[model samples]
Target: MSLLVLLFAVIPITEMLAVRLFSGIITDGPGQFAANPLRVVWQIVVFFLALAVTRSAHHLIKIVRVRVFRSGFQAAGSGVPPNKESWQWAVAFEMSNVSSAVVQIAMFAALFFAFDPITGIVGAVVAAASLAAISWLYQRQLRLQRDYLETRWTPEAVAIPDRVGTRIKHSEIGAFVGTAGLLVTLIVVFARVLGGQIVTSDAIVLFLGLRLMFGQFGTLSSGAMRFARAAVHL
Candidate 1:
C-alpha cells in the first residue's frame, strides 16, 4: 500500500511540481498557471493514473512468478500423476503469458486507430520487446524451478557441470553481455537524441525498451551448455 502511494501519489505530485517550477523559471509561471490551472491538474492526474496501472501490471506478474516457483518446488516425479497445484501452475503460467501478449496487441491496435498512429505503432514494437524480456526472465525462473524439482525427485536429472564452462561463471557472461548491450543502447539513443531524430517521451521509452530487450538476450547463455540443457529441461 505504501509503495502504491509512493508510485501513484507522491512521485506524480512531485514530478508535476518540479516540471512546473522548471517551466516557470524559463518562461511565464504565474501566467500559465493562472490561465489554465485545470490543464496542469489534468496532466498530474494522467501521470498518476498511468503509474498506478503499471504498478498493478507488475503485481500480477509477481503473483504468477511466485505460483510457478512454489509449485515447482513441491513437484515430485514418482511416476504418479501430477498434483493439481503443479498442473494449475504450469497452465496458468502459459495462459497468462499468452494473454499478456494478446492484450498488448489488442491495446496497440485499438490505440493506433483511435489516437496517434505513429506513436502507437512504435508502442506495439516496444510492447513486444518488453514481453520478450519478460519471457526471457521467465525462462530463467523456469529452469531454476525445474532443477529444484528434479534434484529432489530424480537425482539422475542433475548432471555434472562442465569443467570448461566452470572457469567463468554464468553471472560473468551475463554481466559482460549486458554491460556491452547497455553501452551500445545508450550510445545509439544518445546519438539519435543529439541528432534531433528522436523527440517525445515515447521515443525515449522505446529506445530504452530496446536496451532491456538486448540485455535480456544475455540469458541465452544459460541454455547453451549440454549439462545445462539436460538439467533444466530447456
Candidate 2:
C-alpha cells in the first residue's frame, strides 16, 4: 500500500515536472536551455530516474497483489469453488479498485492544497457532494445488478441491463464533465482575481495538475462502479 501511494504521488509530480520543463522551454526560448545545458540535462536525468522508480513500484505492487490473491484463494480451499471469473473480479476489487480510489482521493486533496486554502475547502465540499451523488446512483445500480445476476446467469450474456449500463456510462460522463467544468471555473476565477500576478508556468501547472487530479477522479468513479458489480458476486 505504501508503494502504491508512492507510485500514485510520483506519477503526477513527474508529469507536472515534464510539463513544466516543456513550458519553460517554450516561454523562455531555446536560448535558456543552451545557456544552462547542464541544468537541462540534470532535469532530463531526474525525469528518467523518477520514471524508473515508478515502473519498479508498479511491478512490485503487481507481484504483491498476485501473491496475496494466491494466498487468499489457497486459504479459502473448497469454499471458493474455483470460479475463475469470480476470483478475478474479487482480486480486482480488493487490490486494484480500492487502492486506486484511495490514492486518487489523496491526490485530489493534495492538488486542492496546491492552489489555496479556499480552493481546498471548496474542492472538499465538491468532492463530498459528487461522491455522495455517485454513491446514491451506484446503490440503485447495485440493486439492479443483483436482480440481473440472480436471473441471468449465462456464461456469455451481458452482465447488466441496458438501463443500468446506460446509467453507469452517464455517471462516468457526468464525472468528467463536472471535473472539467470545475477546473474551467477555477481558471476563470484565477485569471480575473489574480490578474497578472500568476505566471504562465503557474497557469500551465494548474491546468496539468487539475487534469491529473480529475483524471484520477474519473478512474476512481469507474472503479467504484466496477466494485458495485463485483460486490454482487462477493
Candidate 3:
C-alpha cells in the first residue's frame, strides 16, 4: 500500500513537477510545453495510471503463483497424480511479464509521441530496442521455468542458492545500462536547454547501448548451470 502511494502519488507528482519545469529539455523546446501544458499534464496522469495498473497486475500474478503452489501441495497430499504447479507457474509468469510489457509500451508511446515527428521517430526506435531486450530476457526466463518445473529434482534436495537463477541476470545489466543512458540523456537534454545546443549522435548511441545492455542482462541468470534441464526457470 505504501509502495503504491509512493509510486502513484509521490513519484508521479514529483516527476510531473520536474517535467513541467524542465519540459523544454525533454520535449526539445520551450515552445513545446508553452503551447501544450494540458498535454504534459495528461501524459503525467497516464504514466501514473499505468504504474497503478502494473502494480495491480503484479498482485494478480502473485495470487496465481500462490495458487500454483497450493495445487502442488494438494497433489502431494492426495497422491493421485504429479502436481502441475510447474506448468501453471510458467504460464502465470509469462502472463505477468506480458502485462508489464504492455504497460511499458503504453507509457513509452505516451512520452515518445509527445515530441515532434522527427524526434518521435528516434524515440520510438530507442523505446522499441529497450523493450526488445526485455522481451528476450523474459523469453529465456520462461524457458528456464519450464526446465526447472519438469526436472526430477525435488525442492528438499536442492539448496536455495542453487535455485536462484535459471535465466539471465537482466535486471543488473539493465540497471547498469539504464543508469548510463539516463546520465547521457540527462546531459544532452540539459545541454540543449542551458547552452542552446542541438541533439547529438552521442545521445542516440547511449540509447542503443542502454537497450542492448538491458537485453543481455534480462536473459542471463547466475545459477542456471547447477540445475538440470528439467528444473524451473528462475
Please list the residue runs of candidate 2 whose C-alpha ends up more than 4 Å from where it truly belongs after superposition: 29-31, 55-63, 75-78, 84-88, 115-121, 151-164, 177-185, 188-194
> Residue-wise lDDT of candidate 3 within 1-234, one digit each (tens)?
223223323322333333333433355444555888777666657656655664564465456555655666577673323475464444444443444334343443344334323333444455556555555554565565565566638753434455464232444544444344344444544454456443443234334333433232232222122222223432
Per-candidate Cα lDDT values, in order, are: 0.45, 0.62, 0.43
Top lDDT model: 2
Preferred candidate (TM-score higher): 2 or 3: 2
Stretches off by above 4 angstroms in model 3 are: 1-101, 115-119, 154-159, 166-168, 194-234
**Clash counts for the predictions, in order:** 0, 0, 18
Ranking by TM-score: 2, 3, 1
Q: Assess every candidate by TM-score.
A: 0.41, 0.74, 0.42
Q: Which candidate, 1 or 2, would have the higher lDDT against the true structure?
A: 2
lDDT of 2 by residue, 1-234 (tens): 455566656655555566666566567646767798887777667756766765675576667766656666677664644565584546464457556655665666566556545555555566666667667766776786677677775664454467466557856864775586467547653864476645776566666655665565566666666676677776
Residue-level lDDT tens digits of model 1 in 1-234: 223223323322333333333443334435656888776566556656655666565575656566555555557433424544455444545444344434433443343323334444544454455445544544564565466556745745544453334413543454355455455445645665677665544344434344433343343333332223333432
